[model samples]
Target: MKHLSILVPDDRSGPNTVACIAGTYHAFTEANKYYGTLGRKPVFKMELVGLSKRSELVNGMLMIQPQASISTIRKTDLIIIPALGGEFLEKNFVDEKVSAWLRGQYKKGAEIACMCTGAYMLAATDLLNGKSCSVHWKSAESFHQLFPEVQLKIEKLITDEEGIYTNGGGYSFLNLLIYLIGKYYDRQTAVYCSKVLQVEIDRQTQSDFAIFSGQKKHGDDMIRKAQEYMEHNYDRKISVDELSKELAFGRRTFDRRFIKATGNTPAEYLQRLKIESAKKALESTPKTVNEIMYEVGYSDAKAFREVFRKITGISPLAYKNKYNREAAELLFMNDAN
Candidate 1:
């Protein structure tokens, strides 16, 4: 049986923290039971490992007592890091013991999986330096600032490279658990777990769910001004030359500053801003695709649809059908009429 060590971080304390830990444990244990029904031995010998025997989180609301301490586990087949709660601050939150333990486990041939902002903890070990990771889109800016070497694939729901795996933000960790079940067990087992847990399997991207809020935390005054201008005037055609001249900056300098601050070029930023606006209109208004396109300053139908697909991984009508509840109801009433 594979020994799975689910690390209960000493510093993490919150409802989210509790959910991930309990949820992961439940999923794996349930998978084991499913295996037993098929006349097979349990696949994983799972245990909660920590720096200490017991730890209280969220102001003592949740107390966790680990089955094994970090020093006690000389070898493990897998390490699962649950999502951390709260803001990922600039303060040094890297636990040396945990980091060392992770590295030792990896060297000892253990695969690592980090759920949501647990990627932050994995990145601290420097194992994810050159690896691609999927984090919550909301934390993308902060994660970029902290771990620039790690390639952040915000649109992806899961990232698996080498022995390290990562999942995107929120309750999407359930998807990762399902994925791991498919990998470690059989596909039939994974499907069974999904149905039992009420989670959809094979969800590959979080793009459609991502809300594009421009990254402006880089502290460049001119770039901030440019971002505000683009956001305020996203409903009209925006020329890069006009922004440059207005800021009295040369084209190259303007581009550099904008990219440095926002992690997107001037054009990409504008496109995202327009798409975000378009998404809002699609969700709330009974607007046609062309109407939303024109409302967001796009005159070309084909160009707008292409860009929408490129950014959001879905077409305009599909997005509306999925999100526009009022429009759907109205259409139903019209059909009745």
Candidate 2:
């Protein structure tokens, strides 16, 4: 059987952390049950490994007892890091023993999988330096600020590179679990698990769920005012020249400051703001695509559709169908009647 170590870090205590651990454990065990039904032996010998034999968490309300400590585990085929909560500071909760153990395991040819913010721990080891990984969209800015060396792909639901895997935020880790099941077990088994677990198979991106609020944490007062103007006047045509003149800065200097502060060019920032407004209208109002396009300052239908798809990974109509509150209410009423 393949050895699977689910490392329960010292600070791994949160609402999502517990669910990720329990959910992943159940998924793997259920996969083994499916294998047994087919007259095949189980694949994984799973255990909760920790720094110590017992770790109290969540202010001592919960206690996790590991079957083995990292010191005792000589080798494992796979290591799974559960999602962490509270904060993303590396120095705050990182265990040096865990980091060394992870690096040692990787050198010994063990595959690593980090679920959601667990990527923070993995990244702390410097293994993800210069590597592409995904994290929760809400944590993207913080992760970027801390680990500028690691390529953060917030739009991706899962990233697999050279045997290191990272998944996106929230319950989306279920998709990653399904993906591993497909890889280690079989496609048929993965499909069975997807059906049993009610998880969508082959999900690739989380962009549709991400809300793009313009980054405004920098200390550029002029850029902040410009951003506020663009946000308030998103439905109007905005020009960089006009903004620069209004802010009393030269065009080139204004562009440089805007990019430095917001990590997006003025045009790109405006487009994102318009698209975000369009997304809101699509979700809440019974508006046609053209109506929303015009409402968000887009005159060309093709350009609007392309920008929407480029940023959100879905078409306008699809977004509406999935999120339209009016359509949902109408369907509910029809079913009731």
**Which numbered prediction scores highest in lDDT against the true structure?**
1
lDDT of 1 at 92: 60
Clashes of each: 0, 0
| Top candidate when judged by TM-score against the true structure | 1
Give the Å error, residue 334, model 1.
Answer: 9.7
Each model's TM-score, in the order given? 0.94, 0.90
Residues 1-337 of candidate 2: C-alpha lDDT, one tens digit per residue: 9999998878756777777878889999999999999999998999999988787767677888999999999999989998887876554367888899999999999999999999989998999999999998888877876787888788899999998999999999899999999989999889999999999999999999999987777779999999999999989988889889999999999999888777678998999999999999999899888999999999999999999998889999888878998877776788899
Tens-place lDDT per residue, model 1, 28-87, is 999999999999999999999999889887778879999999899998998999998777
RMSD of each: 2.1, 2.6
Task: Name the 10 consecutive residues with the lowest summed lDDT in model 2.
Answer: 85-94
Cα displacement (Å) at residue 207, model 2: 1.3
**Clashing residue pairs, backbone N/CA/C < 3 A, model 2:** none
Stretches > 4 Å off in candidate 1: 248-250, 330-337
